[model samples]
Target: MELLQALQDRRSIRKYKDTPVGREAVEHLLEAARLAPSWKNQQCWRFLVVTDAAKREKILAGFGDDNPGKKGIAAAPVTIVVCADPAESGIENGIHYYVADTAMALEHLCLAATEMGLGTCWMGLFNEDLIRKGLGIPPTFRIVGITPLGYPDQDPKPRPRKQLNEIAYFEKWGEN
Candidate 1:
């Protein structure tokens, strides 16, 4: 699929079918993430894929009941725990490159999922300590985010977005 079409078709899916995501499909998404550019090519990002039901339950427990993606987490056949090693990246002008690099990789993962006719929802708000302990993640690694990947069960309309004029400027910040 074309990049723009994939971008436009992508949505934060909260519902999934009782279907399994094949290992090859999972690998394809990972390949896209692996190709994403990182600061100094250090590749700080790491993906922990959870497919077991019991483990998914544990991850869900870390999320609050009010989390919008709770149902998706429970239903998805795969959930990728995105982590980053801050040591692999640097900080410039108070900006952390580790997060930026990881985020770019996550976007690659999500877009690849969309192009493959799969669904994913980027989840972030949760108890990090619980996730780190439950998932046995290293204390040094930062959990950048989690995203449920599966076949979508619902067809959602596109959400609103800011106009280009409102976000982009011709020459200056305020010049729309």
Candidate 2:
């Protein structure tokens, strides 16, 4: 599918089929994320693909009882944890580049999943320490996000978005 089409089609998939996602497809999605640009090319991002039921349970433990993503995590055939090392990225003007870098990579992964007829939901509200401990992730790494991947069980309509004129400007800020 074209990039624009993928972008348009991508959604926060909260429901998934029992179908398993193959290794090649997972790798293909990761490759798309790997090619994403990073701060100074430090490539602070790391991905943990969890297919084991035990490991999935450990990940689920990190999520709160109220997080809507828990259902998707429990249902999807696979889960991916996105991590980033701050030391591997730069900080400027009080902004951490690691977060931005990993976020771009995660978006790439999600879009690739959409193009491949797979589903993903970028979930962030979780206990970092719990996930790190359960997943055996190094203390140096930050759990940026988690996602469930599989064949989508539901097709959700697109959510509302701000119009370009409302969010954009012609040369100067707020100049339409």
State each model's CA lDDT, in order: 0.95, 0.95
Clashes of 2: 0
lDDT tens per residue, model 2, 1-176: 99999999999998989998999999999999999999999999999999999999999999887998799999999999999999999999999999999999999999999999999999999999998999899999999999999999999999899999999999999999
Score candidate 2 by TM-score against the native.
0.98
Name the runs in model 1 displaced over 4 angstroms: none
Lowest-lDDT window of 10 residues in candidate 1? 167-176
Per-candidate TM-scores read: 0.98, 0.98
* Cα RMSDs, all models: 0.7, 0.7
Candidate 2 residue runs with Cα over 4 Å from true position: none
